[model samples]
Target: MSRGFLPRQHGAWAMLLIPFLFGMFAAKPVWQHALLFLGWLLAYLFVYAFLQWVRTGQIRLYGRPLLLYGALLMPTGAALLWLEPGLWPLVPLFIPLFLVNCYYARRNRERSLLNDLAAVVQFSLIVFAAYELGGGSDWRLAAALFAFSVLYFTGSVFYVKTMIREKHNVKYYWVSVGYHLALLALAAICYPPGLLLPLAVLLVRAIWSPRAKLTVKQSGMLEIAYSLLITCSVLLVYAV
Candidate 1:
């Protein structure tokens, strides 16, 4: 017998977990937010299944069970709105992004740079929502969190492109390196000094990792370690 599992989008999961954790850390965690997070995760899983269904059109891959799961999870997610009715205003804002994602999925351009940035926006929204869920009312903090997430994930897009799709493309490789360096400089000039820690690590990785000719697993493991360091640095900065 085999057990059913939720759709596993490995890279996407990392994006989801990291930003959500950062948001929770940036604000006080409460049970309601925890519940909301659980619902949000389930909702994403449902969306993943739905998108896959649209992309593949294969019932076996995402059939009745997934539909059922998505249906059941709706109320679970509705709990979040009940927790804070203020979030109701935010729902309409997502419609355009959802349409963008759907359009990309329909065209099989989900991995395109535009779509990738859209994903970054979506993930950043999760952090912003988390901040709100934690009762944070500071617009500046929310904006900062959203911008940081976008900056980090956009770099991830270039890094992944260099490693895989554009592996042999010298132009993209140099672009990735340049972007990383620019990000480091920007962090140093605009943000707290502590940000330099992870930005420097990212810069070094961009400059050196691709040249090292590491295998896919090696690259992924290195990224995970780097992400951990970035998250830790953020926590430390806020802690002090």
Candidate 2:
């Protein structure tokens, strides 16, 4: 019996995070900005921890570009915490992460950082879209929204894989689409906290796949289904 969606660690992380979100969302308006900064700093901490112990022989996620990835991501996220005016602050950090995740994937040509990194980027875009829907137009807050979305979505993927040694052979489109719509809905309902549901699905999938190869027809089906579903979901949200 193969695992379907989540790793054991994801469940544990979810347990810890649920409390944090509850508190953050419950804050006063002034605290929301501070909480956003805290989230950015937490991301920096993730990189720091990844760097400090990634080479412990038991694990080795930081190498070459990822090392540089850690270097820039810390300051980039910090600057955004201070300024919160534009996406420039995050560009340096995210571009490097995205490029390197791609580089590693290309170099290794396996289920490497590329997939999860892409997931994060895509998720960030979805969060960005939420701004337009929610009638937000601030460039700075828009960027932060995108950044946190990326961090949460991609962060979930990496954490799940590292902690649980999640393995899978899959494509990512509708899953993320479902995630985007779900997040949008939650945002509409004034429950940005609900975004975790779709993300959790990805984390779970990371840990519990059979790693089976799909036939050409099956692969085509998945791709088409993903495209159609995501398009419809996004359109429906916009229409509403």
- Which residue pairs collide in model 1, if any? none
lDDT of 2 by residue, 1-240 (tens): 212112222222332332233222222224334445354435534443343333232234334334454565666556644654443443464556545544444454334657455535633542332343234546565554444444444544543343334423233433433444554455546424434444344334333332334454553454344333433333333223
**Model 1 vs. true fold: TM:** 0.93
Q: Write one digit per residue (lDDT tens) for candidate 1, span 31-135.
A: 877777777777677677677677777668677657776777888767778868877876776678777888888788888888888877887777767777777
Displacement of residue 176 (Cα, Å) in model 2 is 13
What is the model-wide C-alpha lDDT for candidate 1? 0.79
| Candidate 1 wrong stretches, greater than 4 Å | 1-5
Worst 10-residue lDDT window for candidate 2 reads: 1-10
The residue ranges of model 2 lying beyond 4 angstroms of the native Cα positions read 1-90, 102-110, 113-115, 122-214
My TM-score estimates for the predictions, one after another, are 0.93, 0.31
- Total clashes, candidate 1? 0
Kindly report which residue pairs in candidate 2 clash with one another.
3-208, 5-204, 5-205, 6-204, 85-140
Cα lDDT listed for each candidate: 0.79, 0.41
